[model samples]
Target: MLDNNLDTIINKTYIIDKTPLNEEKIKKVIISLKDSIISSKEEITAANAIDIKNHNGNIIDFSIIERIFKNINNEKIYYGNVTTLKKDNNKYYGKQYFDKGNVLIFNTGNPYIILEIFLKNFLAGNTSIIVTTNYAYGLNKLLETIIKTVLETNNLSPDFINLLTTDAPEELLKNNYANIDLVIALGNKSFQNKITNYSKVPVLLSGYETFDLYIDEMLDKTFLTKIINLHLPMHVYINKNLKIDLRGSMLVDGVEEAIMQINYNGNGYSSAIFTSNDDNAANFISKVKSKIVTVNTSPTIERLMDIQVKDLVLEKTVIYPNKKKN
Candidate 1:
């Protein structure tokens, strides 16, 4: 149960310094977590296998294991050193600060995605309270145990990470908790609506929305088929032969149409365009309304990590006498 002591632990995060020493320490924790999971792969799989059997819903497969390591590798590269004072303008100086209170995260997906969110929040110097509303008995607990060990090993408080296995986390949300500065919910539309309806705290919704890929006829047909195959796992392909429909994604006549369709129907999360035409790529990237836009490649986890920091942090500007005497 999250208690007053957890609030104290969350309060302590405000004092975390943005020094190189601190940065290295956080990085070490991530690296150690990766190593620990790798060493215990067999045991971890066995534990989750029982969880799958008990769940009797969806089978927990090896893909989860791969995602665990993949998320670790993706996030370990972000050292979270964005806290520096800079000139906002000639008369003002600005600096970024992590949230002074705890971040309450409710997610139902590959359990390891919590690890990614935890690392992002932890590096930004905000404590996380993870409430897994799905099958929390297996991988969630295992991940929490390993993370607590890593935290203690690195001389950080184990309370830095809290994983609540309770199914009804909305109960916790109903309280007027002063320490909860942010709430991030990752799941389907129904799940997101549940969180939004209950959470008085601000909510950032992620996951569950289908990512659309707009193929322009300017590209060669063979390359389009290859790209579709490469992205098969992420997108819903109506045809195995690569005849992608609007359900998965529709072929557009030009970049303008692609931009229009995506802007009108996209989830405003992340969007990408695979085009060799520099003008087309530039036009699509500039016109698309999604938060993260990329050219010739998909947005990476590193990009998400960068944006996560922005989401969890606030910018402070201190106006002063003009240094240039303007």
Candidate 2:
């Protein structure tokens, strides 16, 4: 069972300070997590293998598994768009970085991608509760155990990292008055709406967010092929279960054709523009329905997150953004 003190723990978390000491402590916790992840990688990958074995409904390829391990590398937790400190707002007239609030993470993309989210909130000084739903027991428990050890080793409160393993997390996840302040969810459109309606709290949501490639009509076939090849693996590598749909693209025969193909096929999480013309890139971003519009780069979640903050961006996803290379 989950800790009985869940409400008590969450209620105490709202205050955050940017004082040097507090920042140092959060920094230490982050470094410890990074180090722990590095030291425990083999163990981590082994745990992932078990989740793969049990989740036979989803096609799990070796290349995909390898991609999972690589995405969990520690650096991603420290860098990218995530910022630990916001400039002081009062005196400096700038931003002050602080914890968002107590957070709940569940059923979002790949399990490993939470590494960054967990790190981000931890740095901001908010406690994060991770609930592993659908009962693929191995990876979830192993991660909880590893995190528990790290927290304990550092003399950090177990409250800092909490885990609940249940067959149905949505029951708990839906309860807004349940002490969770922010929810970062990755589900289909219906489920996303359900979370939005149920939670009075803020949500950094993916799923309803869409993506499509807007190619310049004048681009050469050689560059187009390269772009297509670059994006191809996004489908398989970034949680096929979540529908990154890298292989799904709208061939740019014309505007109607583009819209029809994407309507039928694209996942709409991360989108792209393969254009030498700056005007084309800008126009696509303005007209397209995607939250992330990458110009001259492959559509990956890492790149997406680099473009936007965590909750502001819920995808390239918890599976996170990556491509399986053979």
Task: Report lDDT (CA) for all predictions.
Answer: 0.61, 0.51
Off by over 4 Å in 2: 1-21, 56-100, 135-137, 165-169, 173-178, 207-254, 257-268, 273-285, 294-297, 301-326
Top candidate, metric TM-score: 1
| Residue-level lDDT tens digits of model 2 in 180-272 | 667766544445565666666777666422335555443455765665554222321221222333345323444444444444454556766
Worst 10 residues of 2 by lDDT: 312-321
Worst 10 residues of 1 by lDDT: 231-240
Q: C-alpha displacement of 195 in model 1, angstroms?
A: 1.2
Error of 1 at 156 (Å): 0.8
Off by over 4 Å in 1: 1-21, 56-92, 208-307, 318-326
Q: Give TM per candidate.
A: 0.62, 0.59
Candidate 1 C-alpha lDDT tens digits along 202-295: 8888742224455543256575565455422233112223344644455555678778877765555566676666887788778887667766
